[model samples]
Target chain A: MSHAIVAPVVLPALVAAFVVMAARFDLVLQRTLSIAGTLTLLGLALHLFLLAGDGVPRPYLLGAWPAPFGIVLVLDRLTATMLVLAQVLAIAVLLYAVGGWDRQGRHFHALFQFQLMGVNGAFLTGDIFNLFVFFEVLLIASYGLFLHGAGAARLVAGFKYVTVNLVASTLFLFAVGTIYAVTGTLNMADLAVKSAQLGPEQSGLLRTGVALLLLVFSVKAALVPLHLWLPGTYGVACAPVAALFAIMTKVGAYAILRVHLLVFGGDDLPTAGLAEPWLVPAAIATLLLGTLGLLAARTVQRLAAFSVIASMGTLLLALAMPGPAATAATLYYLLHSTVAAAALFLLADLLAERRGAVRDGIVAAPGFPQLDLLAGGFLLGAVATTGLPPLSGFLGKVWILEVVRAHPAWPWLWTALLVTSLLGLLAFARAGSLLFWKPAALPAPVDPQPQARPVLPLVATGGLLALPVLLALFAGPIGRALEASAAQLHDRRGYVEAVLGPGRSAAMVER
Target chain B: MELLFASGVGVLTAVGVYLCLRARTFPVVLGLSFLSYAVNLFLFASGRLVVARPPIVGPAAPGYTDPLPQALVLTAIVISFGMTALVVVLALRGFLEAGTDHVDGREPDREGRS
Candidate 1:
C-alpha cells in the first residue's frame, strides 16, 4: 500500500516493457538495461525489508480504483520475502548470463525481467483473477526463455512445458468460474469471506470448486503424477535459463501456500479433517521416486530436477501435518530448497562449460580442481536436500517434527520423513562418488572449448551457495518472522479484513 | 441445456485422453488441444451457464452475469492460444530433426513390433 511496497514491482515492469521496444544495440547496452533494472529492484526489496518492520500490510491500488472494482497489490511480510527472493535470483541469473553474451543477450535479459515482473506481481496482487493474469504473463515469458539459443532438444522440451502449463491455465479458469458463480466475487479476500458463509447445503459445490483449484496447482507444482515435464525440459534447457526456472516451481508452491492460508483457511477445507491423508501418501511417493531418480540419473541437470521433486515432497509433508508448525515448516523448507536447487543448477551449468561438453549423461570429461567447487556446492545442497543438520534444512525439519510429534498419527509421518530423507542422502552420495572420486589415472588429454570468459556466473553461484547458510545463521529472527507469518495466515479473518475492508463480510452475506 | 453441455465436455475429454495415449506426436498434440478446449469450456461452465446474460456489470445491469469468470476465461483463451502455437512449433521441429513424432524415443521395430 505504501510507496516502498509499490516501487519494487512497478520499477522492473516499466523497465522490462521499455527494453522490449528499445532500439537494438550492442550486447553491452542490453546487459546494462537488465543489470540496472535488477539492481533497482534489489534496492527496492531491501528498502521494503526495512519498512516491513512498520507493521502495516501495505496496499497499492493500481489505476486508483477501489479494492473489489480494481486490481490491488499487498506487500505483506510473505509478499516482501518472495519479492526479495525473486530479485536476488533474477540478478544472479542475469549476471550469470553475461558470460554467454552474444546476439541473444538483449532479448534474454528483457524477457528475464518480464518474468520477474510477473512473479513479483503475482506474489503481491490481492485478487484471484489478477493472479491468473500474472501467471499467464510469466508462462509466456518462460516459453521464450526456454527455447532461447538451444538446439532441437530445447525446442521439444519447451513445447511440452507450454502444453502442460496451458492445460493448467484452463483448469485455473474453470475453478475461477465455479467460485465466482457460487460466491459472486473474485477477490481472494472476498472469496475467503464468502466461502465461509456457505451453509451446509452449499458445501458440496464449494468443496468441489476448491478441489478443482487444487488440481490446477497440483500440475503446476509438479506433484508426483503431474511432474513428467519438469525433469526432461529442465535437463535440456541452457544452464542459466534452467537456474532461472528453478524459481518457477516455487511460484506454484507459493500459490498453493496462499490458497491454503486464504481460501481454505487451513482448517475447513475438504482435506482438513482426514488423518493419514492423500497428500501425505502422495508426498511420500514423490520423495521416494525423486530420490530414486537422483541415484539412477546419469545427468547433472536431471539429478537437480529430481532433487526439486524431493524438496516439494518435504514441503507437502509439512502441509499434510496438522496445525501451525506444518505451515511454518513449509515456509522454511521452501526457502532452503529453492536456494539449494538454484545453486546446484548453477554449478551444473558451470561444470557443463568447464568440462567442454553438454551431454545430459555424466561422461568422464577430465576432472579439474574447479570440479571440487561444484562437488562441494553439490554436497552442501544435497545435505540440505536430505534435511541434514547444521543447515537451514535441518532446522526446518525439526520445527515440523516438534509440531507433529505429539499427534496420534505421528509415527507414520515421522517414519516417512526419516526414511525418505535417508534415501535422498544416499542418492546424492552416490552421485558425488560418480562425479568426483573417479580414478585420477583416467585423465584424458584436455582439448577444452575456446575458453569463454566467465566471471558473473561464478559470483552468482557463490552468492546462491552462501545465502542458505547465512539464513541458517539468522534462523532465530527468520523463524520468528515465519512464525508470525504463519500466525497471521492462520488468522483468516485478518486477511479478509485487510483486503475487503472491515465489516464488508456481513454486508456481502446479506446478499 | 446444462446437461447437454456437460456431456459434450465429457466426450471431448474422453476423445482427448484416447488420442493422447496414441503413439504419434501429432495425435498427442491434437489430443492435448482437444482436451484444452474441453477444459476451458468446463471452466466457463463452472460459473453455471446462464443464457443471454453476458458478464457485463454497470448501473443498467444490476443482475449481470458474473464478470469475474468471463475475465478469467478470456485470459485463459489467449494463453491457450499461445501454448498451442508453441506446441505446433515444437512438433514441427521434432519431425524435422527426428523424422517421426512418436511418443517413445525410438522408431518402430522390424519384427512387427511398435
Candidate 2:
C-alpha cells in the first residue's frame, strides 16, 4: 500500500499535462521541465528498484479497493528494473533531442512524457485491462513522436506503424474478451488461480485466448512475419524518438515473460507452456531474418533497426526455455540490448548529421565534420552491438549460451546465436569501413554548410555507450540481481499470494 | 440471440481483415475502424447478453449483467476512437506529403517493377 508504487505512472502524467498546457509556447521552459521530470523519474525508479530488490511484492490498491475487484499496481523487482532501464534511456534520448530534434515538431516534450507514463504504467499494472489501456497510451504518444519531423518518409512509415498496431490492439481486445468470458476476471493473479482450475469444456477456449494474447505480444515484440513494420518505422523515425523506441520491443518481451511465467505456467493448467512450443522456432527465424536484414541493410539506421530485432531474438531465444538460469540470462541480455540499441540509434544520427547529403548511407560520401570522434563513437557502439569481447553484449550472449546449454534444443539455439553474432559482426564491419574508413571518392564540396557537432548530443550518445561498459564492469552484481528477479518471476505462487492475501489465494485454489 | 451476436462479430471481422489487406491508406483506415467496431461488440458480448438487467449492484434486482466488460468496452471504444482519428490525420498527411495514397509511399507499379 506504499504510495511510491504509483509515482512512476502518476508523476509522468502530471508532467506531460503540465508541459502541454504551460510550456507549449516556451521551448526553454519545456526542455527544462521535461529534463527535470525525467531525472526525477529516474531517481524514483532507482528507489523503487532498491525497495523491490528485497523480494517483497508491493501492491498499491488504488482508492483503498481490494485486489481482483479494483485496479492495483504492483511494483516488483522485475518492474523496477524495467522502469529504471526505460527512464535512464529516456533521459539520454531527451537530452539528445534538446540538441535541436525537439523543435522539429510541436509537443515533443509532452508526447515524450506521456510515452514514459504509458510505459511505466504498463510495467506496474496488475490487471490485463489496464495493460491494454497503457499500451494504447504509449501507442498514441508514439504516433505523435513518430511523425514529429513531418517528412514524407516518416509520414508513410508512421502510417504503417499505426495500422499494424491498431490491428494488434484489436486482437488484444479479442483475447481479453475471451479470457473474461471464460474466467470472469481480468486481474492477473486472480486469473492465475481461475485458469488452473478450468474445466475441460472451457480449456479449449482459454487456450485459444492465451494463444491470441501471445500472438498480439509477439507482433509488438517484432517476431518474424509480424515484424515487417518495425525496420521501416524505426528507420524513418527521428533519431531521439527512435532511441526511445528501443525499449518498446522490450516492453513486449517483458509482457510475454511476465504473463507466460505467471499465469499459464502451473503444472495443473491445461494450457501450460503454450508459448514454449513455438517460441524458440519463432525466435530463431526472427534471428535469421534480422541477421539477413543486417547483411542487406544499406543505411546505418536500418542496420541499427535490424540489430534491435536480432537482440530481441537473442533474448527471447533464451527466454523461450523455462528456467531461472535462462530467464536470468535473458534479463541481463535485455538490459544490454536496450542500452546498446539506443546508443546505436543515437550514433547513427551523429553519423548522418556529419555526412551531409549522404545521411547515414553505407556508401562513400564527403565527410562534413567531427570524423574521428564520431567514428570512434560508432566503433564503440558497433562493437557493443555486435557482442564483441570486453563489452556487456558479449557477456550477455555468453551467459545465455552457458545457461541454455542443457536444453534439448540447445544445439539449434547455440548455432543461431553464434551465427547471428558472426553475421552481425561482418555486417557492422562492412558498414564501419564504408562509413568511416573508406575515403570519399568525390572532391570537397564547393558550398559546404557549416556543421558543428553539438556537445549535448555527443554527450548523450557517449553516456549511453558507457552503460554497456558499466554493465560489463559490474557484471557480477548485476547478473546476480537479474537472477534474483528471474527467480521471483518463476515463483508464481509467491506472486499470487503477494498480490492477493495468502489465505484468499489458498481458498480460491481450494474452491 | 447469441447466434445473431456471434455472426455479427464474425462477419465484421471478416470484412475488416479483407479491407485491412488493401494497398491503399483510405481502405486500410476504414478497415481499422471496422475492426475496432467488431472488437468493441465482441468485448460487450463477453459480459453475456441479458435483457431487463441493470449492471449496477442492488438488493432488489432480479438479475444483472457483468459490469466489468461494459467498462472495458467503453474504454476500448474511447481508445479506438482516438486511434482512428489519429490514423485518419496520418493518412491524410501521408497522401498530402507523398502525393500518393499507396501504403508504401510509392506507386504500386514502381514497387512491382523494382
lDDT against the true structure, each candidate: 0.74, 0.90
Q: List candidate 2 segments past 4 Å from native.
A: A440-451, A507-511, B110-114
Which residue pairs collide in model 1, if any?
A1-A58, A1-A59, A174-B43
Worst 10 residues of 2 chain A by lDDT: A502-511
- Model 1, A397-462: lDDT tens per residue? 787777767557789868877887787788777767766666254665465445454677788888
Tell me the docking grade of candidate 1. medium
Question: Which residue pairs collide, candidate 2?
Answer: none
Cα error, residue B51 of model 2, in Å, equals: 1.4
Top lDDT model: 2
Per-model TM-score, in order, reads 0.91, 0.97
Predicted model with the maximum DockQ: 2
